[model samples]
Target: MKLTAISALVVLSKVISIAAHGGVTSWTVGGTTYPGWQPYMAPAGQKTAGRPYSSYDPILNPVAASLHCNNDGNNGPIPQSITIAAGSSITAHWAQWTHMEGPVTVYMASCGAPTCDSVRSSGLQWFKINEAGLLSGTVYKGSWANGQVLNSLEWTATIPASLRPGAYLIRFELLALHQANTPQFYPECANLIVTGSGNAFPSSSFLKPIPGAWTANDPGVLIDIYSEAAKSMTSYPIPGPPVWSECRTLKPLSERC
Candidate 1:
């Protein structure tokens, strides 16, 4: 006899409760790997492009300023920016991920300043680049985009080919819905100097503020994955605005992580 999807999810939740939550340990940009900020370690002099965060703890409140990155992601010592061309791929390598359900999304915000060091996360306007939620199956029995990330220990996103060259903050996010009543948000940011000649940029309509992008009442954030209603659904509504048109044209939802 096999356990039902609901029962399986309950068991998974129990495991997640005891397991350590994780964050991005490093990032691979254009085949080069850069270390991510580790809260436990002392600040080594500008060794990485990733912003510093306080810990691996997940952000439970979507309205918190920390949701833009992670805890202290905007206040810590700013690391140097990494150079990468538009249309390239960047992969985030997580320390560990045991959660089996939810979506993995990526967003980009222009730093506006000469370097990202001077900019605060609260002031930037972000636009989605990639988002992958439930790909197929029921909420409990279906295959999820996060499942792929869990198996690989890494998630990748592509920069828009037509994006203008400038300083930007690339954010990597994992929303674990194992306990959907209170979603777990794990987000990290990396400084980037995008090099390219293309001039396409997201318009005002495409830009969304981090804390404002999500709410507790959003269908995706408040869902119960193990419920009968969720099992009958065919699609999952990914939180936040749609992906930028330029990025969507370059990589459709089917191709994104």
Candidate 2:
């Protein structure tokens, strides 16, 4: 009877953990909804036909950030691309997100090719557009969790108004720290074709390359959210290059840009 009770508790814990796994299933732009990355998809599988690659959970490697770029066994970018006007907002809708105490960021990179379908991560430069982390100096405020929007189902970010109009790849990442000791990463990417007259572009200081942009030991990536909460923590570090200054006017659940 005692052993059975212990096993039941263990099973319950596992169920809770599994319930927390999630990913952005689709995105909305200009009121049109598009399918998102396929978490755990095979390179040549039919299900991967038109979707970007991604992993649901249990895979956490920051050094191999490119896998999060388009996934699909690193095959290449998806054929279809989304079009958006400069300064407009895009919303990523997740299947579900159970753990809400960490950072969520949005980034963009120009597609080096005429089309993003064959674009690779090498030589690609990325710039931050938006980030959300540590809301109200606490992960939880009343009944809400930090960085959560649309009941934790969607996250919205605006494209830089002055961004150079061109083909770009947008990457969205969410770091789940509920199990802080082994933070989980949920990074996904989408193809985009910007159609506006904006001309500003990020300089060297504001851009970074994937695989080199993030490190496994980044303070924001490998943190202990559980332990930090007990110390009256008020600030949290967001990984990657600083968000473009001109795009800092909007607010997310973060402490600073």
TM-score of each: 0.86, 0.78
- Model 2 scores worst on lDDT over the 10 consecutive residues at 138-147
- Candidate 1 worst ten-residue window by lDDT: 70-79
Which ranges in model 2 have alpha carbons more than 4 Å from their true place? 1-19, 40-51, 65-78, 139-150, 228-230, 245-257
Once superposed on the true structure, which residue ranges of model 1 sit more than 4 Å away at CA?
Answer: 1-19, 44-46, 247-257
Candidate 2 vs. true structure, TM-score: 0.78
Tens digits of per-residue lDDT, candidate 2, 75-113, equal 334357788898899988877676657778888888766
Query: Alpha-carbon error at 48 in model 1, in Å?
Result: 1.6
